[model samples]
Target: MRLSVLGAGAIGPAAAALAASRGHEAVLWSPSGRGTMGLDGRIAAEGALSGVFPLRVAQGLEEALASADAVLLAVPAYAFPALLPRIAQAMPAGLPLLIAPAASLAPLAFEALRAGLGPRAPVGALATTPLTARRLAPDRVRIPAIRAAVDVAAVPAAATPEIATLATALFGHACPAAPDVLQPALANANPIIHAALALTNATRIERGEAWPQYELMTEATCRLMSALEAERAALAAALGYVVPTLAEALHRASGVPQGRLAAMGAAIAASGRAVLGPAEMETRYVTEDVPYGLSFYLWLAAGRGVAMPRTAATVAVLEVLWGRDLRANPLLEALDAAGLPRLLREGIGR
Candidate 1:
């Protein structure tokens, strides 16, 4: 299949390389238009899948998306609102649009704007990104690992089988069906993890102190993450799904010893994985994860009347630090819990 991969950051280039390795035509585009397009349309990748692969880097979004059988969005959560509308406009009807690591509320927000795009524009949200990757250089990327399994939630749930097949084929991971977008969205581990990490390390981040992120996850931070996890589990229960906590998720992903969630986090931190910390306070751990992630969790909790004091406190701290009301997300507020299941299964007004 010809795949149009958007956002030429860590995951995008790695995904393009993976597609090329699988004998699929993968064209890449950078919405920011700042990255170095590969020399002669080629990118060198290492780590998990190592090789110099041939890829077509498009000059414009339309050029990248045109005639593609599938579209994969690899941008951050904050970029979805602006980018998805442009993609919906340029993409031909019926093309499969997959959001890698579909952060909470992204699919709903996208579906809201994607009205009238027709049945062909089926959107699937993956619970997490396919690869743990980084840009090694302007023309190179390093992928450390692929997740053990992927949960995909498709709007109009009927598309789950096709999307699962395609996603598994493309990434060589077990792709399972999620009940609806809420299942996968709540299953996301980043917001809880990032919320804890960012809040605990706020002072260090402000001072530009650098350390391994996971290593800095102290007992206090892990306790906070566990509290948020409990709140998330309650929210998931209210929504009629069982979501795993961050520690269980880590154990499943990397075989971290399972006991206390904090110990699990400590195990992950001491695993010598070379994961780095945010050098500045204005990092995505607080920015993207706070507003688009934790705040959205609070929004859902409010609708369900589930108290998430820890989660709310975390986002509130971020709001004070960032000088913006992180909890005031209109898109999330516009989406009500009563209408969510139908909205996930169908579209906004359907």
Candidate 2:
């Protein structure tokens, strides 16, 4: 397998190393063009991979995208609209494009790609990232652990088996074909966790206080997490997707509910530093979620007349904080449902 990872961030380098270890010819590309190309040592549980891996690095996006067997969309979701068209412009119509951990906007991306390549381009979308990772050094990454399961599907449904087969060759049995790309997109779990944690810890993050968020999700915080899960689940169901229960995911992540919450926190502490996400505001969690994840989630709920007070309120607060209304952002507007047939014939508003 020949793989090209679009961003040389923590996850990107880690993935490159993992693929190299698995005997895949891997190339990494970063728009900024820094970092040595290597993977060393085995990955630790809940920590970044150790060891330097020898890998190829490309400085430019076009160089990375050219002639690659598979291209992973690792940049922030906000970067998608601008970068996607460029990728589409030069990418071969037959090449496979995979979106790592794509959230609720699969429909929009499928529409865009179809519009670009005439609905016949071979494109695959993933519901979860293949590996959990962090960059421990400029040249090295720590793969905490590969995910236990990965769900992926092709955008047009016809490409699912072919794309899943290719991905499984690189990722092993962890990757499986989903019913459709939309299922996996809606199933991606980061939005629920990030929005809740970010909103909860805004003051600490803004003040640059060294707050331990993993340890902060206490009994009380866990309760709040359930409410957040309910909000996401409601929107997901309305959009015709089923997501895993928060309790089950927590159990998988920390072996909790089987033990006391304090012990679970202790277990996470015993595991050493776990890099959850980017340390900057320009992170995908914020930049992507505002438009793709949060706005989409809110839109689905609003379309169904289901109140998403928390989700909507958070968007308002974050828009003010960020000095931008994400809902009106260019990509968000482009991806909006546009009353696609469901309402056009109803004539309810008129």
Best by TM-score: 1
Best by lDDT: 1
The lDDT of each candidate is 0.78, 0.63
Compared with the true structure, what per-residue lDDT tens digits does model 1 show for residues 233-312?
A: 98889878887668656765555677876666567666644467777876877777777778878777775678888788
Model 2: weakest 10-residue lDDT segment is 341-350
lDDT of 1 at 57: 82
Instruction: Supply the global lDDT for candidate 1.
Output: 0.78
In candidate 2, stretches whose alpha carbon ends up further than 4 angstroms from where it belongs are 34-48, 110-121, 250-266, 276-283, 321-323, 335-350
